[model samples]
Target: MSTPVPLPITWSPRRNRLVLLPLSAAMVVLFTVMAFVLPANWHLNDRVAMVVSGLLFAGVGLMLARPRVTADEEGVTVVNFVRTRRLAWAEVVRVNLRAGDPWVILDLADGTALAAVGIQPAGGRVQAIQAARTLRDLVDERAVPQDGSTTAQG
Candidate 1:
């Protein structure tokens, strides 16, 4: 029998900030221009502060919008707001998605739990559940069994 080939799967938050990020950047530019042109009875320092604050807001928007999780035959890559983690299938012990959880959690063989923030419940309960199930299945298909048998061999 021929074994089925595993395809790469990528999961990201449903509500992407692609639009928000660009919109925010435009707002920052608008604010910068307004800070210099608009007559609001404000001093130079106040205008400078407003421009800086707008830039900060745009930075925050960019941070919130850039998380993703990708998995393939070799391993999984998780890119969070501030950190990125890559783990081989053998390192993952199990996938955990429970009620009231904000995101999918990965239990690793090293006794550390990694949060898959990209697969969040905020997307929708049904969608989140389906993603968790799919990720679990992929992990199972790639992970080595306790009996020393590899899933790919089957």
Candidate 2:
């Protein structure tokens, strides 16, 4: 019997959380402050627009940081900037994170590959590789054969 992996593991991009988020926050604050401190000739409406644009910038940054993957016994959920996808263990045939690739890719049974933006090397190559291995193990564990033909006998 294959040992069961612990359920409910989550993976997120460390770069987004640690680097992008803080930079976004700092930029937002700076933009807001600059809006009020601009030249006297600048109209009040222009200042408001500047602040609004800054808020929008933060929104995009937050969206980028939102990507994550939650894995459980049944399946894995991939949440990206604008979309979320759920794949059952059976649907995920393989997980690949090749060099220069932006994120993990899930090869499905239907011959289609889905980008799993949640796991990216931008955070750290080591962490991303580890996450891919964990996910790959989960998928392989559930891919047991119905017959024992592949089992080796000592």
Candidate 3:
């Protein structure tokens, strides 16, 4: 029989964010230029405010595009726009993929749910579902057996 294919140790969105980084940078530049070139019947504070707002917008864009999920032998790490969380493989009780959901949600043993922003439905439903399945498989492979033995195969 053929050997089993190796499962991925990590999972992330199939879509690349490289494009967003540059696009957001361009927007910031455009806004900065407009702040100086666009004539507005307003005070200096208003101009500064406009520029700062533009920068904040760009920052948000960059932050949203930087989300990622990484898994290893020990646990998984999820990096969202505002926060990063790490959960051991044992802590993940279930993986949920629902229709109309933007991303995969992980149900933890602690009665909390964690959104896997890295596995976004925006990458296409098929891809997102496959990613969720892969994550589930990883969790199963790392699960602890009833006898307190580890199930990790690699």
Candidate 4:
């Protein structure tokens, strides 16, 4: 038997730092400044608190900035944070690009939605859209139809 080819799949955070990072940093800075302005006794627990809070914020920042893409003969895999989901080419119903935010909304056969972040919103180069469309077509081609039309409906 021959090895199967991989379907092109791309994954990225829905948004990179336009919202998460600054807010996290603000929280850290706010608390650190608060600790400084407050009286020493009140500040007793502040330093530790700030450090802990800062670390938490930093973790979130890192998570939000992480983006990855993987494609294999079976299907595509999109990973976000601790959650990683995959879809077989036949399982993908359609690729939707019209929305307030940018994402690859995968309509699965089981009525589930798998969204690939950052692929939406036109944030990347022109190639991003092209790549997304190509993947969409590939998924559509392999997708199983529901109404007997042989074409996957989204």
The lDDT per prediction is 0.83, 0.86, 0.78, 0.65
After best superposition, candidate 3 residue 145: deviation in angstroms?
3.2
> In every candidate, how many clashes are there?
0, 0, 0, 6
Cα-based TM-score, every candidate? 0.83, 0.83, 0.81, 0.62
Candidate 1's C-alpha lDDT? 0.83
RMSD of 2: 4.1
Q: With candidate 2 superimposed using the best TM-score fit, by how many Å does residue 52's alpha carbon deviate from the native? A: 1.0
Top of the candidates by lDDT: 2
Alpha carbon RMSD to native, model 4: 6.4
Candidate 3: 10-residue stretch with minimal lDDT: 1-10
Per-residue alpha-carbon lDDT of candidate 3 for residues 1-154, written as tens digits (9 for 90 to 100): 2334264355555455766777778878887887787676767887777788788888887887877778777788988778999898888988899999988899998799998898888877888898788778777777776466665364
Error (Å) of candidate 3 at residue 152 is: 6.6
For residue 138, what is the lDDT in candidate 3? 78
Q: By TM-score, rank the candidates, best first.
A: 2, 1, 3, 4
lDDT of 1 at 69: 85
Question: Which whole-number lDDT from 0 to 100 does residue 57 have in model 2?
Answer: 91
Indicate whether candidate 1 or candidate 4 has the larger TM-score. Answer: 1
Q: State which candidate, 2 or 4, has the greater lDDT.
A: 2
Error of 1 at 47 (Å): 3.0
Expressed as tens digits, the lDDT of each residue in 1-154 for candidate 4 is 2233344545454456566777777877877776677766765677778767777877787676655546666777777655777767667777766545465676777888777764655556455566577766666556666765566333
Residue pairs in candidate 2 whose N, alpha carbon or C atoms collide under 3 angstroms = none
